[model samples]
Target: MQLLSPTATTYSELQNAYEHFNKVLFDNALPACLITLQREKRTCGYFSAQRWANVEGQFTDEIALNPAYFAVTPIVETMQTLVHEMVHLWQHHFGKPGRGRYHNDEWANKMESIGLMPSSTGQPGGKRTGDHMGDYAVEGGRFLMACQALLTAQFKLSWYDRFPAEEHVAHGQASYASQLSDPAAAISPAQANQALANVVKPTVKAARQSEDGTSLQAPNRSNRIKYTCPSCAQQVWGKPGLRLLCGGENCDSIPFV
Candidate 1:
């Protein structure tokens, strides 16, 4: 695939890619959903099963891509991240069981069936994590082949300008709040929470709160837990078992603690 100028990728571009892949790779089995560009601190991408009412007052599914993470990544790798999350969306809609942050056996089977093999180490044939695994697009896999075909067809994946100025810009350097001016950028967490409130009832909230008044948030991401790279000591805010790799280009091979 010809690598185009690394200009900022827009959310519309992401949606285009999602649609193309959904039709070609998934035979268009997946339903329509919201495609967004998120400035997530840790993960490369995310798929939410929780439905929410958008600004138009219509409920929709959500798939969020982290611009900060994908800005420095290769386009093919970025496509892989999108496909990976699509698998999650597929599982959620198809009744595949997953516990918390773990990518269970059923999920793995589905991933493999779609040409992605999960590895905790982000390498082909790396150590597996029980029945669950994470990271790395399998080399010579069906997903890779499909991406290659798309690239051959001259599909251009746009990049997102995660920063106001490109100077001294490395990956994951800008904060989401600072770059809300972009129309295609994902909604901020506060906006997401507000939107979710319209769909998720208060009874669900009561069940998640602790006796001490603290609320149990998402499984692998919480204010109480922090992820730090053992090599560079670059700390990212998230819970343990999040599969967070060091954001440093050179130290990315090292998993965060």
Candidate 2:
């Protein structure tokens, strides 16, 4: 380590330290994204903001995502959102946008190819609430996310070819329920239900369809409750019991038990 250190006062030394510190800070703040991009075969940069004018977009040489858009959102959703933005950046480099026009069918297809896009599911924005928007607008956003996890985690799909929803949920994605679960305790019925519901009903399915073939699946008219636990406000699946359970390891509450 000392050999690379020219004098501590050297511009090279100072620059290296600064760059190293920045990398550490950024990576720690967004570790999952950093790791995913490393595995992907694309060149780009990502940064989180308080909020974004658009959910995601491509600049001259980067893709920017705002975690604030879904600040209270699950980690998988955030990842999927960022991946969606990254795909657009890729389109800027790989496809023909005809000029400054960025969002188009080409970009949309790219999302589907990798399974980053949601399957058609529930309502518009999938399941809109005060904090986070819903998943896909159709009915199979969960299935899509599952498929996406299989593609990316198992088949090693590129970031451009995957959806963040499934990736976060699969293999126990902690991003979705980190605050809601007892990491080491028995998965609560309510927590489990929420996870299942989110898995089954993805947000991307809720988007409005376009005639231009940009939308992944045709929206369905299904009106399920989206299975959320009333206690923690987590999306759940399964025939829920009377009691609510927390997903956190330190705190598992059986409200009715």
Candidate 3:
């Protein structure tokens, strides 16, 4: 916050956000990743695996956030995008990943475990796994708690796009509306509204992240679509509208119908 130039401040803020979430959400097990601010048309952010290497063959993954959406995107939504990509990074390292832009259930479940609900439609009942997905903070979720913790520790994102894109919908995140409906954790929508009174800066109204995720824009693709591999006859279910591949070993198969 002192004599640092604009470039330093902007990247530092994002890097700090990554570090904060890594500890609280991922237990700090994820290695450091190169963070960049590159804008992709209609894309909020993305995680590209092993995009960089040193002369010694040291490799590093890349996570790029779109600066174009910075000014217009809410702080929490920006956090969601970052974590969404981080989940991808995690899968690339540890779990079995679906090839070529396919989001597997493992990724979706991990997102849920960390407090971000994955949805192709960006809303409740949306497909949990797919290409080009949207996500929201979970109700009474660890992600929300982590956000509260990060803001409380006085983190700031100091830079943004000058010509921000037109925001289509206000992506919603939950405060404490847990799906379990435990009386101890449940809160009314009005209460959820008041939950972020001191969390988001520049002062914006907070919306409740509906149970399961947000429904602001993804196709409410059917929830019961099933696809089976033609070669191995390995049957798998997919959310309607999600493109998936047959993961059967050595089976050259087309995507799920």
Candidate 4:
């Protein structure tokens, strides 16, 4: 399907891209799932199990891409996010068990088999974690190659404009939380748009106080620990006493303080 324009925002384009990638990359092995665009902070895309229920009272998997994040990202990088979540979905359905947020070796191996080597730092090589490691995709990997091929074939891909600009909020500012009482009943497109219209945007505020009434402050940069990738000179900073990897798909350099 050819897109009407480079900046189109039609859902059909997204669906077509999903179907195309499923056929070309996964050999049509992945099951069908609901794909939606959401306005998420920080997260580029997410894959959740059984988040939506259909008219038949059966739960279905969901893959939500953050339009706010993707609007400014390169098309190739956007495809990377999609493929990354697909990898997660694949792992969740068929691969070995993974604990929490850690992507196990089996997951990494599967990702590599598809031409997306995981790097923690978005670089080239990454640290080894009991044989597998968390990683981002490498440049010129299979995933990118596939995306280029699809584009070359004139596949339609749509990306919308960025969300309206809001007041800048520092990282780790106010915390906004929500709970799902129950799966929402399936609704039509009109109903969905009405529901979205009624949603209130969250506001950012200063950090909250602790139990003892002490005001929270941002972490001290001096006291925090830092990790450096020997190969690419990439630096990651975080709380003290934690080991980190260079996170580069090709570099895979062990981090040092």
Best by lDDT: 3
For 165-227, candidate 3 gives per-residue lDDT tens digits of: 222112211221222334322321211232221122222212222222122342233435344
Provide the lowest-lDDT 10-residue window in model 1: 208-217
lDDT of prediction 2: 0.31
Most accurate candidate by TM-score: 3
Q: Report model 1's TM-score to 2 decimal places.
A: 0.56
* Ordering by TM-score: 3, 4, 1, 2
Candidate 3 Cα errors over 4 Å, as ranges: 167-257
**Order of all candidates by lDDT, from best down to worst?**
3, 1, 4, 2
Q: In model 4, which regions exceed 4 Å deviation?
A: 1-9, 125-136, 164-257
Q: After superposition, how far is residue 198 of candidate 3 from its true place, in Å?
A: 23
Relative to the true structure, how large is the alpha-carbon lDDT of every model?
0.52, 0.31, 0.61, 0.50
Write one digit per residue (lDDT tens) for candidate 4, span 1-257: 97465434567677777887788789888888888765554455677767799799987777777554232223454566677678777877788646655666786787787777665533444453322233344445666567767767766444343231121111111111001121111111111232321231213322222111001124343454433443554656665434455567765544432
Would you estimate the TM-scores of all the predictions? Answer: 0.56, 0.31, 0.66, 0.56
RMSD of each: 14.0, 15.1, 17.3, 15.5
